[model samples]
Target: MSFKSLCVAFGLTLSLAACAVGNTVDYRDVVPPLGVSGSKSVAVEAVDQRPYVLAGDNTPQWVGMVRGGFGNPFGVHTVSGAPLSSDLTQSIIDSLKQGGVKAVPATARMATDRTLLVTIKNWKSDSMVTTSIYIDAEAEVRDQAGTVLARNSVQERVVNEGEVAVLPPGKLERAKAVFRRLMDQLLNSSIRDALR
Candidate 1:
């Protein structure tokens, strides 16, 4: 190859290397297993018609590697190709109902016993050029009046060195599953707290 072409290739390689070296998923702290029983019930408002933030919504690339593979590796957002807010929200609502909860209709104009406002502050993912995947999320819940009820920012790390699934099924599916599971835990905790 021409000298100029070689120089360009070297520069690109260095740039990519820099990006790779910059961010690494860190889940060193031991994360205790999530022990949530669906027995408890919380008075949750009907699923809001508004879009539910997709798993890894507004997530960063670095966070992706910790949870699962990025939906769209080339896209700006790591989990960009994941379901939309509405899809995710509906999924959660349905899961909650099945698990055990009096779900209100999203269109109900009247406010119910309790309303929950969830804000997903950050979601991120990461993976090497060849293989490996993961995802993370930071979320919070508030009451109808906007009082912070509880906040949690945790990263789910699924290190894929070779051929062992951190998730039950696989990484991508596992990420989605984890998202739903996290929501379940949130509901469980919220209900337990509200009842108290």
Candidate 2:
């Protein structure tokens, strides 16, 4: 092929590539539904850090969603194959910190002065992309040697703005937000109940 033709083809390819790159979409940056408030009434204490449990294991627990099936298209699922568990855990930890509650570490020095066990039972979103996340969280706080300080279960459902009341496209995000809000509530409630 002639050099002139080769250069022209190369330039056209580069231009097309540039345009494609520029038009790339980023769903991650999509604006989530509003009305997510992380306010709570707990005076988080800077005290002993405790370990948490998930599914009967004394490990770093994750705020998992149950998953919306069939009609629940825009439900809580991974973006590009990344599981939402990690994000959920981080959100919970952040909310706990904001609420002033001391979190138990996953491992190391102390023998877990306290243990917080959590579980997410069911999660779903609707057809019009409206998301509704429901979580059945069980917080079982125990001292060293497995002595239960407090054991409580909390069920919270958070709804977001979308086309239908079913679930939203940002279902996973809504679940995480609601989990944070509910964590604060649960932490405060558990602490208060334990004290009483």
Candidate 3:
């Protein structure tokens, strides 16, 4: 075999190996700190997620994968993992409870006067040597009569410090950080203000 041909084979092997790494998607839960106090009782309604965010099987769709370094400038890869809207809804309810608000599951009756509705506008990640996860959501508060009381939009960006292929766990950690931050902002500020 020629020297150039051998080198080409070796490069192809390496690229395939890197791409194979971190193909499985994992989920992390968000837990908020306790301290802030509020005087509102709210029932968390089902969260609405954009259609393109999920796969046909109902799992979160994998965002496109990105390569590290500058060798293949035009290469795009697929990433695994996404948080379900139900999971996010639960997280928000938990955070609300921690923040001294009476939060309950949404029901047709025997509930609070106010209902919280959340819409996930964007939830995506950009992979590379360093990965950035972006989350954007909007929340609204309404009375039993369907009158909109208050609404707010929250967006968060988090960057992880590692290559996606080398450290797949770091990507999940960064995603958790972004989720936590978004929940914190919503529970402490946005939702609190809306209730007031």
Candidate 4:
């Protein structure tokens, strides 16, 4: 190619690199599991414990960078449109209620309610020509004065490759599947009973 052609190619690459690679999709609204009877009263508090501080935050959000690859990790990130902690907290409460449990946010007072602390331990993706999403969370129930009653954790992963992985629907949509799986396990696990 001519010198002018090379210069134009380099400029084009630079402009593409300058484009935003951040993703923003809310990770809520999983299908609630069938409500169970004789569930217990509990207050829920969710926390995001992932240790990475990513780039770009124009709104209240939760973000995790996609890992694996050289330099900036494909310059992509997985983000949620709302603060993850509160979103999980509310989702947990709603799920518990739909499951026939008396559930509320930690801020709500109760006569004799167990406190459920749910934590986001990991939320990440790996990609090259493929994208693999992973997520895990732990839920612990404690009595008044913080005596642990029960604890359980759940994790999920999904891999996408070939044509679909690099095509439309984006990172956020791919990640939502893993998040849904994570929530489903929480609803049907021993942790839900322990909260009672």
Q: Estimate each model's TM-score.
A: 0.43, 0.45, 0.64, 0.68
Give one clash count per candidate, in the order shown.
21, 11, 2, 1
Q: For residues 62-123, write the lDDT of model 2, one tens digit per residue.
A: 22332232222211233433323343444444454444555433333444445544444432
* lDDT per residue (tens digit) for residues 128-163 in model 1: 332333324433444556566665544455443543
lDDT of 3 by residue, 39-85 (tens): 76778864546555543423344432444334332222223233455
Q: How would the candidate models be sorted by TM-score, starting from the highest?
A: 4, 3, 2, 1
For every candidate in turn, the CA RMSD to the true structure comes to 10.2, 12.5, 5.4, 4.9
User: Which lDDT value does model 2 have at 7?
Assistant: 94
Tens digit per residue, CA lDDT, model 4, 52-76: 5332332225444443323254334
TM-score of 3: 0.64
Superposed model 1: Cα runs more than 4 Å off: 1-83, 105-108, 124-149, 155-158, 164-170, 180-192
| Model 2: lDDT of residue 95 | 50
Give residue 54's lDDT in candidate 4 (0 to 100).
Answer: 31
| Candidate 1: clashing residue pairs, number | 21
**What Cα-based lDDT does every candidate model obtain?**
0.39, 0.41, 0.59, 0.61
Poorly placed runs, candidate 4 (over 4 Å): 1-22, 53-60, 65-80, 109-112, 126-128, 155-158, 163-171, 186-188
Which 10-residue span in candidate 4 carries the lowest summed lDDT? 53-62
